[model samples]
Target: MRRSLAIGTALALAGALAFPSGAAPLFSGPTDDIGEDVELAPSSDYADLEDGELVVDLSAANPEAEGVNDDAVTGIADVFRVRYNGSQYAHVWLTHESEAVTFYAGGEPIESEATNVTLAPNESIAVGLRVDTTGETADGLLDEITVHARAADPEDVAAQGDALSFSGSTVQTRAPTETSRRFTVLGASAGETTTFDASRLALAGAAGDLTLDEVAVTSAGGSVSLAVDASGTEGARSRVAERGAEALGAVRVTVETGAVERATLRFSVPRGFFEARGVAPADLAVYREDGGELSRLDVERTGERDGRVRFAAETPGFSTFVVAADRARVRVADARLGQTTVAPGESASVTANVTNAGTAAGEQTVSVTVDGSVVAQRVVDVAAGDTANVSVPVERDDPGEYAVAVGGVDAGTLVVEAENETDAATAQSPENGSDEPVREPAGFGLRELLGLVALLALVAASLLLARRRPW
Candidate 1:
């Protein structure tokens, strides 16, 4: 009996040593074993709402007593550990007791938290967690996280007894990325407020999609005001306006894309656009995808007022419109006349070179003026970066020197000659050998007198011949 008692004592010592102080009890409850596990219900994805909740089912169990495993009737207590990298985005809690939750930011206890949930053998308890994300930004949390759950004995002291413990975790839920729909704003005048449908700028949301909480001008010298409908059924409105010299600069408005896809945006024309370009609203031109091989689209004017032009076009994707004015600058390059000297009842040809010095293309009128009178005029059509020569015919029946001008600018001169008197005197008195000039009848030259004398002689000769001839 003494030997048997000694053996029994030694065996008990060995058992105690084998099951270390904080280790699980050797004879844990009835089933001779301590077991526990945890699981999450539904899914892990969660909305970034101000207040929310999650359900976690924690179970602990011990089989029926059998043979040497006669002590399988025991209770279990579960402890949970919650960790979030962005504590500001969410204040997390586990169970109904506020003290049980550990805040990651300040390491303070949450208002509704506690630990050590008691459970019977082969029993399970569902614990709910409340989360708050009011302080979170539109795109606060961008990664996935896990909430840890551990099961252990409620009364098990450190380094003592069978502390039945097991660990399970649930992925931290996250909101879905926002995508779908498009955005555009009607053109606006500088320093003036323009209204746009803020709802349209918003990305389409899924059933529980994560969306932008606010719309703002990221780099533009512009201000945006939001008007949210309290009824929740009406779309929001946004008013945007440019400030200072930024109206002449490139401005942009930005929103969070929920890290899903690229954002499409359209902006209104700022006020002072027409004044800055020195062009009328009707002269505005829009182009897109016109570089290289792409063709230009026909942009339609929506409206214009107060030196501001608003227009729209079919955009293939998100991009800024190529806006500009269509106009041309015309000038006279050169003026040339075919003949500077001519006789009476003659004409001279004049050519004027017109050039377009502007970026736009159009037609111009070129006119030739002799002695301040518009003698000839023609239309000259020239394209951008090109020159056109226009021709005009000038007639001068009087004898004199005349000044010529083309397109209202002085060009050159033209001279016309009158009938010669020396030739007429030589023909009338060939034998006189006189250097004196003789006055004759107006409109009667030497050729005319000679023709008249010949005609009179021929008539006399004909009469004599007729009289001599017999009937």
Candidate 2:
């Protein structure tokens, strides 16, 4: 330690001597910009520049400064060359409000061997300094710091000769590094972790003055994922605006593929966690699966074992499972709403809407199609007799009129024209309200009409006579 100090002192002195500011300064007084302005421009010229050493007088009540991390220290080293005793010389110095300080000038030497050169009145000097601190983990911590120096005749540095002045500035030291780690409370009732596959996750180190500390979890080992609401992780209560940072908080989590398949995560209530109005247990877990309840299971009084959840055994090409209590408790029939129509050059998707036609509420795996192709399919939950709609996009995939059917109901021809044409010809003509009047070949036309009248007259005369003798 002694050797290091000696080396530093020698360098500080050598640097001060080499510095060009070794000329007398035109102005040597307090500067509001660089340091505290104590004695500005002196009260008057009568205040001899020789006796005009700058002085910063503080009030009886010094303003409280921001607290800094005690473990760390920061300081500024200044090099000044000024004319004193009618000769040019250098001076390098370091100061810290409360932390340790290190100063360097030329090469390296001992403080005892270094000469203390004072400045002449109104002499200027070159100054360069650095400030640093340790242990300031949280950002925005502040501390008060001050620096002062003197300039006097080489023969009388103790007496007012050239000039003596005060210069100081406020310093705020912090270690935004470790403290930069943002945490978030990923709440969960279940003890299990939401595993984010290493291959799937693409988290790189923080950039631009930021760092990341891989979250440490008790549940699983190896590069574990960040569970925003991990069970027993972190939370926000009385505070507002900022939450979910410490629990391995990142500004955001981005998913690739434009497809979000593994996005689902599970979280359960920790002990003493508050329950919402609809929730039963003050503590519970949550899961969000497509087409299903927010979670697979919950701890609400209303969802008692009789919470028995049911699910469809198979969803055509896909299969699903249900809670043990619901396996046989419910009977589910999947009524498919398949593609019914496809216009020419047009293609339609096949999909189904599973209604819990059953007496109880349950979840099921269902299928849907987009443009005659399978695209959307998932396991969803529904209440008893309630209906859940599933509409998969149908891209004609091709251009041409096509025949299709929805729910096995045939949907005839479809026109895949950019615009549809009128189908007026397909319609039937209006009825004349007559079935050809049952014409007997028109009965030879007019003769038939006359013969019908003659026959009626003969029949009437015969009937009149027959009525008298008829049996």
Candidate 3:
């Protein structure tokens, strides 16, 4: 019994030394525990261990210092770490339930590939996060970053079973620092323009001097206070994104006492907004939501200066306004002729397919040319990422072969036949198998017999006169 006990003790001691300290038992069967030993811990200066979970606070974070105009901040490298204490190999990945924050791993955004890692016993990986405050007016808990561990490799087979273990961290944000301004317009009249010092209303990342001008209040003469805020709403941001546009920001203009009839407001937009969205200045537009309907306002680019572009927009009343890039590109895809042959003075048509491969609807002019001359033209409206058919009627007065083209594309030849006068007369004739009855030829009538008798009497009188003269 002593010899057997000594041998078992020696074997147990060897097995204990094989794995590192604080590692789980070796998994031997399919029913063994897989990922329950995984834990998450703060790995960087920005993160903290709270309530057994990692937390990152962005309340005092200033994005303006990073030269970013939009309200966004990126976390440091390895903000947090995911450690697996299991004995068997496991597949680990990170997921988040937030739209405002995005996590990163290994200096690259953890959208898909970077989020995944394979770990043996006592292995760990670090993660980071980026928080955007563009549409975040007030802030609280922003996101929950979750780390999932599974026994089976997701690449090899579908992750059908439940996760073995899951751990997460919370991200919190506070309201960003903002500067606001209020202007008081007393005894405002129609057709009167008022300017205010709107420089303070610009966002924290805005550079250079800012100005507001040509503010025309079309309401009745009264005193009103105009308040402007430099923040935007989440609804406006989502709507702009759905339209394939990037929202620069939103400005909220409110009337303290009563609403106005209409107003024309001009403001400065950051030049960086255009560069970041990769949109041209001409595509910039303003949108306003009224009565649950979002409508685009009449906007015009006035000028550019001091690293900012100026735009004037007409608004219905006091409300929030969203500035975005609305670009529309229209082109012709194909052209076809309705009929290749037509007679003179007959009408034919050319159809042109127009496509708008842009973010907004646009109008395109489809022109049909015959023999180097524009025979028909039409203006067609095509929706974004859609195609529309535009048909233009064409007529030919001369009989000949003409080269047909639509929207600058060669469509083919159009042949107009000469008018056949004989065929037209034959169509009207009864003898040519027409429906009308045939008429008989005209015979001797009373009028003709009377005319012949008068002629004979006159001839006899003339003969008697001549005979008397000769005798």
Candidate 4:
């Protein structure tokens, strides 16, 4: 019992050392076919594997011991190991059987070497089977085959009778080659993005897996692998890794450190809108998803403007878009203060609010005019991060329309008013505070002339008579 336990412990330790840790699971597929070959090898995926070794024991069922290989055996065994790559495995047996009659592999011919072996009721034997995954083959993961088997009689062979099977798995490896692949660019301008698909890569033409290294984008900002937050999927990864670089004006794609495989990729650049505002316009270059430039578009100056430009596309292969926001104008939108509204000869204050809704800001003038003449002006020093309010006072001499303007934009009329025209004094009417009687000026003068003539005649006649006598 001690010897048996020590042997089992040693086998377990050896098995543990042979396999390395931290690899994806082995035989990670459905176990469907566990036929005669299962008896040749016991495996975790025994129920799923199709090709392996198989052994049969038909002792009681076939009392004649007549079978396909002409082997009269109390037990049978098959073996499986070594899968792909250059890794090799110690001979591990694979088998299925009943202890009545038996079957064997293609090693011994009929009657030449007898396969009959004796065993006690519940006794078992360990067989060794090795396969060559030495180099690439048809299935592409295995080599040639070399297996070993032996049997010994212990007790009566008629004790055990039931179908038994076993199976296991191994690992192999392969080298990298050139191929094509599918890639995607997440950010791009609408007009500058392509809509290419996976079929365009055509990796099969390269006969192996494709790898892309040292990929760079014109707008990638000198960074590599522009997959935001390490979320690079099999479909694609950006060549430029600099933050927001994938949305820049240029990106370069190539195999910086690996092989190329043929594959198809489909992707698109993000939608973009460009606006022209303020004094200076912009000149921008646009690139397609395939890294091809379309054309340079010119944006013109629009006073106090607000608008956007949109782009869209659909292509067959992978694509990305990039936008260049070069030299665009910034502007503000707000009310323009005009002339103050006040009664004739009255003083009132004029005020205007300037709100910036653009990328740039500076001081602007608000000039107010009343009755076609400049009445007041205010110079508010505007800053990039601040809003300004301008206020000024003006004396209104007449009642008419007042005009207000800011940054060359005209704001309509402001009205000033005087008292009503219904109350007035006329020559024929006498009213309130005046007690004088109503009369025409010419008639009043005629009545006063007769009195003046009488007084003047009396004085003159006396003076004339005295002067004549003296002379």
- Residue 55 lDDT in model 1? 20
Total clashes in model 3, counting residue pairs 3 or more apart in sequence or in different chains: 0
Model 4 agreement with the true structure over 324-418: per-residue lDDT tens digits: 33221223344444444567777555556665432234455556665456666666665444577766665657787666544434544556787
* Rank list by lDDT: 3, 1, 4, 2
| C-alpha TM-scores of all predictions | 0.33, 0.18, 0.33, 0.26
Worst 10 residues of 3 by lDDT: 1-10
Clashes of 2: 67
**Per-residue alpha-carbon lDDT of candidate 3 for residues 1-471, written as tens digits (9 for 90 to 100):** 000000111111001101111112222223234434555544443444332223444334523223113455544565556566555556666554445566666566654433456555555567665665565531434223334456645553334333233322122111223444545443344444455556435532233333343355555543334556665455665665566654566666676532477788787756765666666766777777554456778778888877777788988786667766786778888887889899999988887788887677789777789888987778889888899888877878899998888888987788899868898768768777788754446876778899999999999999999989955
> Per the 3 Å backbone cut-off, how many clashing residue pairs does candidate 1 have?
21
lDDT at residue 94 of model 2 (Cα atoms): 31
C-alpha RMSD between model 2 and the true structure:
24.0
- Those runs of model 2 whose alpha carbons end farther than 4 Å from true positions after fitting are 1-28, 32-90, 94-146, 149-248, 251-471
* Tens-place lDDT digits, model 1, residues 1-471: 000000011111001101111111221232112211221121211111111112222111212111111122211122222221110112122222122122231233332324333222222232222223223221122121222223333443333334322221122212222222112111111233232333322222111111122222221211111122112111111110010010111112222111112222232344664565576655544333222222233546556544434454443432222333556667788887788999888988887789886546768777688898887667777886688888777878899999988997666888998868886566667376765566656878889899999999999999999999999
> If both were scored by lDDT, which would come out higher, candidate 1 or candidate 4?
1
**How much is 11 displaced in model 2, in angstroms?**
28
